[model samples]
Target: MKNDSYPTSTIANNTKRILVLFAHPVPQQSEVNIFLFEDAQLLPNVTAVDVYAEYPDFNINVIKEQERLVNHDVIIFQYPLYWYSTPSILKEYQDLVLEYGFAYGKGGTALKDKLFFCAISAGGKEEAYQTDGFNHFTIRQLLQPLEQMASITNMTYLAPFALFGSRSASREDRISTHREKWTTLLNALATEHIDLDRAKNIENLADLTINGANE
Candidate 1:
């Protein structure tokens, strides 16, 4: 695969750890997300978890989840955009794991200063999520609640990395390229090569121009 314009390994380190909370109810049927998760899992300092598979009963293990969060510097909530929000289990994970005096409230310093972001796959085209489009709002506008969640927890919120039109027919090369970029970003993130502020301000981390955002 071509490296394209971005330097996949321009920098390197495993100091910052990453946790990918992949919440797909029917992961077996996934075409893109599953591949991204598996590739990310093979990288150094990255942990990918299938949330549904781990807690099928919706009975979350709060302590264990919290422990997982504590070990990672970056926490990624990866899921397909369902009704402009996350899957039900992610909400459940938050409700159960982010307890008082832990994720938010007095002494809620566990996730403070950590990095938090989302990776979403949308069935609609990118233009459909704009002011004049059928959806009538940008992706960022729809993610305000998540941004607030990061604010409350004192975590840095980076704009999401999204793949739109997932339900549409796709060319093999295009899919291959997007898959490569997924691993590239994961590698950059593990090495602390991304400019946090740049990532936060960018409209779309998946934009091809994101090469400029990497440090």
Candidate 2:
């Protein structure tokens, strides 16, 4: 059953609509993203779509999904990082919904002028994502493919909103931090306060923490 609480036309009015495509295999087992999504859902002009729950059979409604994309000004992909990438369903959704003639290639102007961002939860510590760290690569490098995808689709790619140390973060801390960040991101998007130029220059959302503080 699709959640139509926030219709597409309603999204085009008053505020810039932010469609959050949330993908998690087991939401009950999630600690960070769940709270973040819950908090984000409460904000006006923000709509949360549980991809896994909505399309468990992988039978995605491409037209409907594309319609949702065209109606919103910003698209936020929310998920738990799996092996340094997004969950399986998200990839599937991208492949199916963001088709060649629709999101890219000739006549693919549906997503043009739109914005794309990510909100992800990682199981590793921040240090581990560094060049000399265990993971041996920055999160920015790991997420380059999505940036390229956004570029190909003519969408403005913004810095992601990431929560590291998910595996070790205390339940209380996880909830608190994710909620705060979710609220902050929503407010920035709602009020057009985000620094798009800075967001495009940075590799990862974490990098924005250092840059945003200076601004």
Candidate 3:
């Protein structure tokens, strides 16, 4: 994928900047992630990028992605939870975009002091991800690799924004509450209202309540 040049802006003295990396293979078939990306893109300080649309062949431009990272204060990885992890393209993006000297290892200060987060949709129900539930392991446990990645890169890893019961969500349900959740999440990221410490302490992103402007 070619590097698409976007206008760079100075981070506000007291405001948090956020970058949302959205990846969905079949957007036409998505029930929740598409709405989440749409809502997230409306935030003033959030730069939302659709990876699948940009790098359809998995040829990621590492330099361009790193440049985007350097310009943002917070980073968000948004996608659906496929096979208990991110989509294949997202993993490829991670392997390519987050390089050895730019995102981690020595002299990799580009992501330093920045925040990292995940926004995901799961086909399973909320109760299915519990210890005694069908899925067995919790969502947080499933995301340990990402948390370790953040730790290795010296970024503050925040809790995820998760939408559960996606497979059963009706169109009307998505239009009402789910869309509102996406809007609230975007607003929170743009305004620095997200509590990273508290978010990290939670076991499931679905259980975390976002206190938005309407609330």
Candidate 3 structure quality by residue, lDDT tens digits, 59-117: 89877887788788888899999999999987897888777766677655567778787
**Candidate of highest lDDT:** 1
Give the alpha-carbon lDDT of every model. 0.82, 0.79, 0.78
lDDT tens readout by residue for model 2, 81-180? 9989999999999988887767777666678878998888888988999999999988878888998999999999887777788876765455575566
Clashes of each: 0, 0, 0
Candidate 2 wrongly placed segments (more than 4 Å): 1-14, 171-174, 203-215
Question: Candidate 2, residue 142: CA error in Å?
Answer: 0.2
Clashing pairs in 3: none
The alpha-carbon lDDT assigned to residue 175 of candidate 1 equals: 62
Which model, 1 or 2, shows the larger lDDT? 1
Best by TM-score: 1
